[model samples]
Target: MGFAERFPRWTSAVLAIIQLALTAVIIGLEIKSIFIDLAHGTIWVGFWASLIFIKTLVMMLFITCCCRGRCCATYVLAWNIFSGILACVTIYFDRTFINDPCKCYLGDKLCCAVRSVDSFRTNYTSILDQCGQAIANNDKTALQWCSTGSPPYDKVQYLKAQLGCAVGMLISCALYVVIYIFACLGICFGHD
Candidate 1:
C-alpha cells in the first residue's frame, strides 16, 4: 500500500496503544487510591469508565488492523466519538474531585481523610487524642495526617499523576478522531 493508504492505519494503531497505556495508568492509580481511602465516588466512576474504554480501544485496534475497505469506517467513527466523550468526562471528574477541599490522613492507622471532623471523631475515637494533640501543636509530621485544608502529600501526587494520564488519554482520543476523519474522507473519495 502507498503511504497515503497506510497512514491512517498506522496512526490509529499508535493512538490506540498510547491511550491504552494511559488508561492502564489511571486504573493503577485508582486502585492504589482505594487502598489509602482516597478514592472518591468520582474516582470509582473514572475507574469503571477506564476499564470500558480499554475494551473499546482494544476492539478498535483490532478492527483497524484487520478490516479492510470502507465497511468498518462507520464503526470506527462511532467508537472514536464515544472514546472522545469518555475521555472528556474522565478529565472533568478527576479535576473536580481532586481539587475539592478535604482532609487527608497520614497517620499509622488512618490513611484516609474525611470531610467532617465530627464524623472522624465519632468514627476513630482511639486516635482522636493523638490527632487533636498534633493539631494543637501544629507538628509538621503529625499535622500532615490531621490537617483539614488540603489532601495529603501522597494523595496529591497520586491525583496529579491521574490527572496527567487523563489528559494524555484525551489527547489520544482527539488524535484518533482526526485520523478517522481523514480515513472516512478517504473512503468517501474512493481513495481507500
Candidate 2:
C-alpha cells in the first residue's frame, strides 16, 4: 500500500541509470580539474565516486539479469545504503572545493585577471610567457597583475556541477533503498 509498492519496476532501473550518469559527470569534472592542476579536494571525491559508479554498474547488471526474490532486494538495499554514505562523504569534500577560490598557476606564478574558461584557454600560453618575461625583468606592474587574478570560470563551474551531481546521486541512492525495502516487504507479504 506504500508508494514504493505501487512504483513501476522500471523506475528503479531509471534511477540507477541516473545515479550512474551523475557519478560519471562528477568524475569527468574532477578529471578536467586534475588535468588543469586545479584538483585539491576533488581528488578524493572523484576516487570514491568512481568506485561507487563502477559497483553500481555491476550491481545493475546483476540485478537485471540474474538477481531474484527478496534476497536480491536485500542486497540492493544494502548497496544503496553504502553508496548513499559514500555520496554524503563526497558531497562534504565537494563543498570544500566549491567554497574555495580557484587557484591557477604556472610553476608557482599565478595568472593575472583570468576569469573565464575561454580566457584561460585562449590566453594561458601568452600569460605564461608574459609572466616569465615580467619575472626576468622584475616588472612590478606586470608582476602585480600576475599575482592578482579572479577565479577561473572552468574550475568554478566544474566544482558546482560536481556538487550538484553528488547531491543527485545521494537522492537516487536513498530512493533505491526505499523502493527495495517496499519490494522486499511486498515479497514477504505475498503481495509481489
Off by over 4 Å in 1: 1-7, 38-42, 101-153, 190-192
For candidate 2, give the lDDT of residue 67: 60
Name the lDDT of candidate 2. 0.64
lDDT of 1 by residue, 1-192 (tens): 433374456776777788788888888887765544542323464577786678768866876578744546556657767876777777776676577524333343343333233445466554566667766776667644434434534555666678788778767777766776676666567664
Model 2, span 1-192: residue lDDT tens: 533344445756787678778877888888776554442224446766669666875675566556644566566768778888888887877677667544333333453433334556788788777778887887756755522543334465777777788788889888877777666567558673
Q: Pick the candidate with the highest lDDT.
A: 2
Worst 10 residues of 1 by lDDT: 108-117
Residue pairs with colliding backbones in model 1 are: 106-145
Stretches of model 2 off by over 4 angstroms after superposition: 1-9, 38-41, 102-153, 190-192
Which candidate has the highest TM-score of all? 1
TM-score of 1: 0.66
lDDT, residue 26, candidate 1 = 88
